[model samples]
Target: MTQLADQRPIAAAQEAAVDPAVNSSSTTTSAAELEQLRRARPRGPHRRSPLAQVGVRLALALVAVVALAPVAFLVSLSVRSTDDVLTGSWLPGGFGELAWGNWSAAFRTIPLAHMLANSWLVALGSALVTAVVAVPGAYVTARAGKRGARLSAALLAGYCAPPVVAVLPLFFLLKEVGLTNSVVGLALVNGLANAPVAVWLLDSFVRRVPVELEEAAWLDGLSVAGGLRRIVLPLIAPGLVAALLVCTFLAYGEFLFAVSFAQTTASQPLTVGLSLFQGDRTVQFGQQAAAALVGVVPVYVLAVVAQRWLVGGLSQGALK
Candidate 1:
């Protein structure tokens, strides 16, 4: 009986151990099954509720309307009759009564074609000059150490000084050289004015490029300028495009310098030409609106065309 009792306890212990093993096996099987089921389950498309979708769409529509309202008003004013404008009517009179003559009058009253040509020349020249000055400046600033940083800061400070402060001095200096009332002189001045911003922008872009890449080129017997031309330029093409666009827009839209420097139609840009619509006693609102619309077209077109590059360039160095 003692032997039998000992045998019973041994059997009980074996069963206990076996039971835990069986339970663990079952638990693991169940967990694995659960995981498999989760994987096999179908995931439907994410969908907003109908009401939520409507609300979101409506909010977007409202934003569009608010943003476009000013542009719509400008268009309406440009096409409206002079009588309607003089009578202070905020709304259009009629589609049939629209004054197409306002556009023609604007062209006749101002040398619109000449002004536009001059503006284009200045804008293009400024962009070219800014690129020339800024690319080198940015390269030096980005590669050099503390001295480059100090120089960059000085350039920015010069840009931040009110343009009016330098206008008189620049005018007198140009006058001495017989460059006053000349498109070339105006473009050069615009280029210099915009160079600081161009340098700052290009500096940011250049810093994003790895210095090791440039060093590797040096090891391969490439000069610094060669490396910059072949490698750095291609890598930062988007940034260059953005810089040129910004410089062109700045020079194109500049009013203070254009008005001060351009004394005659020969050198006058569109911004200065727009002022001719204003008489001593009265302003031609309809003709001015038409001219304003013409002025806005190029910027609008550029924004539409280069939006992708602009966004990409602006967003560079934002992430690791």
Candidate 2:
């Protein structure tokens, strides 16, 4: 045993002679080398130089300012007096002295509250209709492979065509059904018009869903519809919300169809009702701007509220 112990020291010495790093402790030496390697590694692409980062930030700030300039101008117009509007000054006067009566004047000129309600109804209806048509269609197309691609292309091609071409046909169709000059009628038209867009938006989202999930669902005794409802719908909810919001915005801003279908104050949405601000003799510029600003509020609020889902839906298929 004594000789064996003496030989252990000899073995240790030989090992230390061969590898000095292992003489102290292998773990400690390996950790040190790892740290050194980490320090020597190159920075990632996102780690920009200070000057380059500053320039990029400045450029982004400039773009944001340019994009928001029109909205700021619209706000300025909304607060202007009739005389200031006629003068065409960017700002009516000192900010504190600017007229605040335009908002009230807009409400007075037309049933602004009622028009806003009509617009909301149409927008909500259009979104609902779009979701109903788009979700099933998108899912089917996404799973259909090349045939689905052709169908999606065809739908988008129809969307690319001018809405004007179908205006007369749509008008006659609605009239035949006794739906002309009604908000419901207008909502139906807008919903069908925007369905193609919604389907296109949702196709990628549906495709991102793994076939394995549906296969598992089937193993669990779920039918195709059950799998869609139980698994796919929940997974693609963000995309659905995004598509609905887009359809709502499209319906809200729709003009040609709104003008043709909804003629009365009860049925007319904000887009068509805004025309009342224009007279044969002159335009009620301040009132128009005020109403326009009011009309814009819902859009902004929706964007802010749904910001997360919107971004998520858009980027759903980007990474995974």
C-alpha lDDT of residue 40 in model 2: 92
For model 1, state the Cα shift of residue 317 in Å.
Answer: 4.6
What lDDT is reached at residue 140 by model 2? 88
Candidate 2 all-Cα RMSD: 4.3
Q: For candidate 1, lDDT tens digit of each residue in 24-119? A: 887899999999999887765355668877898999999989967877787888888777988988878788889888899989889888888899
Which one is best on lDDT?
Answer: 2
lDDT of 1: 0.86
- What are the runs in model 2 whose C-alpha is more than 4 Å off? 1-13, 17-36, 40-48, 95-97, 219-221
Please tell me which predicted candidate would have the highest TM-score against the true structure. Answer: 2
lDDT of each: 0.86, 0.88
Tens-digit per-residue lDDT, 40-98, candidate 2 = 98888597789988999999999989967877887888888778878757776787868
Q: Which pairs of residues collide in candidate 2?
A: none
Off by over 4 Å in 1: 1-63, 317-320
- Candidate 2 has its poorest 10 consecutive residues by lDDT at 311-320
Candidate 1: residue pairs that collide? none
Q: TM-score of the candidate numbered 2?
A: 0.86
